[model samples]
Target: MIIGCKDDVLPKPASQLRLDYPVAKYASFSNHCPIEFEINEDAVIKEDKNCEFSIHYPKMKATIYLTYKTVNNDIDNLLRDAQNLTYKLHTLKADEIIELPFINKEKRVFGTFYDVTGNAATNSLFYATDSIKHFVTGSVYFYAKPNYDSILPAESYVKNDMQHLMETIKWK
Candidate 1:
């Protein structure tokens, strides 16, 4: 048998993919919809019937779903449903839910924004309502499995887009 001196065994460092996205540029978007908002230049908006929309980000493998509802003296119900979608649905796996309340009286937009940590299906959600005439809710979902660690970079980018969309909403 031959014996040879060898260097101490050391674990190789792990290499991770450096994921990044471009800076967001927004432009006003509306299509026979009751409400309008500034959408990211990168997003592909697919408007559905009843003022609903699916904002697709192919690079991120994600979509921002938007639903618009006409407030028919049922603001309370709409508000509760939107809140539940954020708080109740993701409680199972979310590490924490951070709420950011948004109000733009001039635009008549009032709502809450949620940033969920952990491996929840959705990392961001928001609801904006005039509380008298219009209500809109949006959420983002990645196509891949909900691995927060893996998608954090993309999530961060899309979240900014989401926030921008919310802030620029106008009842039309």
Candidate 2:
């Protein structure tokens, strides 16, 4: 007697779908300084030790930076202040744009995008400027840049990956 297995009988390994997503292209700006990722539609997820994780797409871009300080310290307060500032920024009129108060005093550019509004995407970006303190040791920044011309709509897969990366962030 001879036994033959079906052509598709072989079991496949668990899917590493998470890692399969497109990652941002890492670029170096200054020597021995913070790394910067070029914001683009293909930049879906990023994981790094020295720098924070950031996602950029056609219609929107989000960044989550891990501060050097621990979360138990003043990070929580800083995040709260950032959130409050975001709320106030959103209250401004559509034609008006203002600086977010929580931004570093030294940095002239506080918020990047304006015209805050809601969308159909599963994940929400800090239309203005928003941040959260991680339980582990640092804080995360979330920023969303939407396309006004409707040239390239942000893909759902990229958005989903961004959400996963944000939710999965943990200190080593």
Candidate 3:
């Protein structure tokens, strides 16, 4: 006689659910083209010189990267650059949707979007792309999913999470 049984998959551990806090205040250089923006995760503020932050949503098994630098000192230039990048991304044919303003100039591209705000300050999201990887820079308040090719169907939760993340960004 032969016996057969069904197989079951186990869930991830509680420890696995928590994400590793990004190395704060570490300045690192990258050969890849640079994108800069600012970050405000509650009371925690991090500035990326040339390094970007990558977060993974295990439940979704999706990975997203947030690359930003603080422009607390030069708000005007940051705004100008943000606008310029917005225009640049507009020209690209991305399967993804990005609601931001930018320009597409020769050898450079730029785009910008406003973060969620209350009465005091507003944050911005920016991106610039060339022949290779798209450089994304901006301020994000909450945990965010990266804009990668994998995520599909674009569910409401993901959208809301992204929106909330953008909204929390503070200029200074």
Candidate 4:
């Protein structure tokens, strides 16, 4: 029998993939949608339907969908629907859901931001409302299958952009 050193045939340890993103530069975006906000310059904004929009990040293979709704005295129903979406949409795949409240009294913007962790479809979800006239909900989705560890960098960058959007929303 032959004897070898302990390190002679040791397998290499697994390594994580490295992802780098550019520094974010934001520009104000507005339209006839009755709302406006600042968005990352790298994202492409496309109007969906009604006042809805899709913010696409090609390099990250992700998109942030923004849907606009008129309060019309149904604020309760709107809030409920937005809250339900965060739970129902990612409940199966997400391991944890952390919600943070946001309020900008000066801008009359109030909302909840959800950070979804795990192998979930969305990394971030949020909703802003004037509590009387307007409501806007947004969620970021990746084209690739959800793998939290693999996409953490992209997810983080996108989430920051979403926060900026929520904080700066203005009703027109």
Could you tell me every candidate's TM-score relative to the true structure? 0.95, 0.35, 0.34, 0.93
The C-alpha lDDT values of all candidates are 0.94, 0.34, 0.39, 0.94
**Per-residue C-alpha lDDT of model 4 across residues 48-140, encoded as one tens digit per residue:** 899989999999999999999998889999999999999988899999999999999998999999999999889899999989999999999
lDDT tens per residue, model 1, 7-30:
999999999999867779999997
Clashes of 1: 0
Residue 2, model 4: lDDT of 100
Models, CA RMSD each: 1.6, 15.2, 14.0, 2.0
CA deviation > 4 Å runs, candidate 3: 1-51, 58-61, 94-152, 169-172
- Model 3 TM-score relative to the real fold: 0.34
Candidate 3: tens digits of C-alpha lDDT, residues 79-150: 566655444443353333345554555435444443322221112243433323344554332223433332
Which runs in model 4 stand beyond 4 Å of their true positions?
1-7
User: Where is the poorest 10-residue window by lDDT in model 4?
Assistant: 3-12
